[model samples]
Target chain A: MAEASDEQLMLAYRDGDAGAFETLYARHRARLFRFVLRSIKSRASAEELYQDVWMRVIEARATYKPSARFTTWLYTIAHHRMVDHWRRAGLSVVSLDTVDPPAGDPGPQRHAEAREVLTRFAAALETLPPAQREAFLLHEEAGLTAAEIAAATGSNEEAAKSRLRYALAKLKSAVDDG
Target chain B: MADERDPKVSRRYRELGNEEPPPGLDESIVSAARRAAEHPHAPLVTPSGRHRWYFSLGAAAVIVLAVAVTYQMQQEQPDPFATGVSREAVKSPANGRARESAPPAADSSATARPEAATQAETSGRQGAAAPEARMRRDEAAARSLAKPMQAPAVETPQRMLERIVELRKQGKHEEAGQLLAEFKQRYPGYRIPENVVRP
Candidate 1:
């Protein structure tokens, strides 16, 4: 079941196989929600954006063709939705809540250290430009290569790589200092 | 594939992406996706393109043509039984050349006392009897002079039509209709008057 390619599953769904769509939904649910949640930083709005992305996929099932990777197409829809949301909200920089420490059985001192690192990382992510942050999200969350990011964001591969580089550098510097 | 940034930081960020959104959000979104997939988007109306308009235009043209033809036909039919025949000559038969037509005595008897034709016909039968042959001859001659129109063997269609009317008056409508039918078959293209055909 897991071995079936995304395109194959989507094609099955196109042929009216409801279970195939369920598989597709399960596969992308966590990753796509996280992508939207991280971008918007508001759980409620992220849920709306998340539902919108999946609706776009469902609406496009009939016209779905395997021209590109499913993730690339999925993230493209996500990127467009995010852009629309940003435009509607009229926000250039996304505001994020302070990051909580990684959940674990770590000692108090280690937990504080993880919290500090996460807080700095979150702030760093907020400070990056929207396109650059999008590139980074596509890379880390959607697991898209630079070329896939380029296709998703309608940019050149070099630009996608540059944005990803900038995002990673700022986060790395924050981690080292924190 | 060449990353300008340190690989360890990027790997750590990718691991941070493992931080899932709330479980409820995941379930809701997935359920929505599946539900949406179950209820597919309604397809839009298929464009009729120009085919429908083309047929409509064709139908409109046909209707217009039919109406025009009907109107033109109505305008053309001044009289249903009009055969385009020149009746002027027959109506004004008193032409300058009428002097060369039928003899005066025959024309006068035919035009004046139409009943004299029966007397002339009866006189000829009496002239054939031997008992008063010579006397009847003189009487028949005088009758012939009075009713010379009956001596001619020519039968006109006008006379035939009048006889048909007379037959109808005497309750011989079937015979009259048979005669008219024979007249129609004999003169296939003749444009008989409506009264003549169904009188």
Candidate 2:
């Protein structure tokens, strides 16, 4: 069961295997949580959106197809959920407008010495345009390539690569500044 | 091409540490999935199931349509006994007068006969007499229409010769002559009426 591919687990779950769903959930929970957490400004909203994404997966189990990688499929749901959240919050998803850094640090425990650099990176991530931040999160957290990122975010590979490049450049500069 | 990942940026991003959903959230989501999977019928329906539902509905609609069409066809054909009654009513002069007097009942009797008869039958002795009377009138009308007096009698040679004499009396000499010639051709062995010969 542990050696089963994500697609295999999803198919099993679709066929009424609850255990398979638990395994699949355990496998991607952390990365998906982090991806949603970094994409949005509010921890509460991110938590809600994250759970909604999984619920969508549950609701969609009957219709789940394995044409794409499970990670790409999962991130696609997360990406769309976040986009809906941004739209409801009246945030511009397409604009490259930078946002104010969220209040306090939005990260887990870190080494005392590395805390400053982590803070700088977290703040920089929050300030990035929504598309670039999503592109970066999909690439880093979901382990998706540019093409997978494009697929997840419903963008072309060129745009996805550009967003990821710009996001990495900004985060790099912010980290170096520290 | 522009899809390069910077090692320094990656390291810095990793330094921000991993953030996870709260344990409660995880439990909620996983349990929901398990509940859905375990029950199987509890959550979203499959496309195949939806198609089956549509098929069932469509089948039901077709069955209903067939029944309705059959019923309509049945209604369109005249009932033989009722057809006899309507024909007598139209043919007999006395029944036509009766129908004219009861215009509304006559107009709707073809469709409403069974209902009116049933109602009258169940309405006790007084009301029962009405349908009985209607039945009696219908029978009488049918008998009158079937009587020999109502039938046209076949004409005989004597009647033809008398008709020719009448035509000659009415100053139709040429027509009378044509009829005499035809009578002679048809009944050559019979003697002509003296009145026809005089004409």
Candidate 3:
């Protein structure tokens, strides 16, 4: 069969096609797991939440809609789940200090200086307000446009733009000052 | 100050953004998705239908028990003052010999109809409380029934797709598209061909 679109795959899964779900999961899983891992800062929690998110998708299969990009919807679910987890755990909304970039493989040549800079970058990300950080990640990491980010986050275009701008400024400052 | 800033900073930040996530993440996610698929009917993030059923059944049982108890109590006790004879009088010897043998205090007590009336009024007040309890039971039943019986309609691919179309028309195309993709993946058999998505 021809490769299906994300929406098509979701529709297929809804109709009891397990292969479609596997396709969808294969396509978006890494990015989503990384997204959650970055936000929550715990591998175990990320794994648990990751499982929870997919389970939600499975449960929601019957009602899956083609209204948004599958990835966006998936991320939104992940976002909400992460927020709920944080609330239940009595943790504050992610702070700026906890945002780390994807971990690099350990190597002698990967200088301590680069690691320090990346660590600072992560911290700066954690410090951003949830909206700003989400906007920045969607734009910078996911390659979404400001308008797209706004739609995913349920914010207006202007607000999304403002968040991106703020996130960039903060990140720049953190790198420069460090 | 702005002119002094290095353009490389932005470039470097952007470059760092694209770094691939750790290996095995995708496999882990796929595993999770597989696990989820295996147990499709697990309870939702919110309460499940079974929980609601249990609640409804429990409420019904309580109401039935309360009503039965009330009926039994009503049947066991007859109206006191209206009968014009003390329960004690009926319980005593059937002949006039018992009355003749009864003390004057007993006769005075039997004549106190007002007190008996007051006691009956209190019983009526107690009965009146039952309706309020019954009303509460009814309300609980209504509430249990008020919740939608099945999973919300929004969970369906068609509904989600419709919502996406609406959002798209409203210039929320990104979100609309995202939801559409998610829905499509979840329900692969229900393809809304790209051409017909808008119409």
List the candidate 2 regions with Cα displacement exceeding 4 Å: A91-114, B1-3, B43-199
Please list the C-alpha lDDT of all candidates, in the order they appear.
0.66, 0.72, 0.60
lDDT of 1 by residue, B65-131 (tens): 9999999856642210021111221223244125324332212122223233234346656664433
What is the lDDT for B151 in model 3? Answer: 27
Pairs that collide, model 2 = none
Question: Which of the numbered candidates is closest to the native, going by highest lDDT?
Answer: 2
For candidate 2, lDDT tens digit of each residue in A1-178?
A: 8899999999999998999999999999999987877676667777888888998999898899999999999999988888888879844321113222233565554343356666667777878888898888788778899999999989999998899989888988987897
Q: What digit string (tens of lDDT, one per residue) describes model 3 on residues A1-178?
A: 2388989998887876777888777677666655665566565676788777877787788888989887777767776797688787733323334434435665655655665776666667777777777766666555567766777777787887888888788878888885
- The fnat of each candidate, in order, is 0.42, 0.75, 0.18
Candidates 2 and 3 compared by lDDT, better number: 2
**lDDT string, candidate 1, A1-178, tens digits:** 5689999999998887878877877788778877787788666788778877877787788899999999999999998999899989843333434344465758988877776676667778778888888888788778899999999999999998889888887878887896
Q: What lDDT does model 3 reach?
A: 0.60
| Candidates in order, interface RMSD in Å | 3.5, 4.8, 6.6
Clash number for candidate 2: 0
Q: Candidate 3, which segments miss by more than 4 Å at Cα?
A: A90-110, A176-178, B1-199
Ranking by lDDT: 2, 1, 3
Cα DockQ of the candidate 1 complex:
0.22
**In candidate 3 chain A, what residue range of length 10 has the lowest lDDT sum?**
A90-99
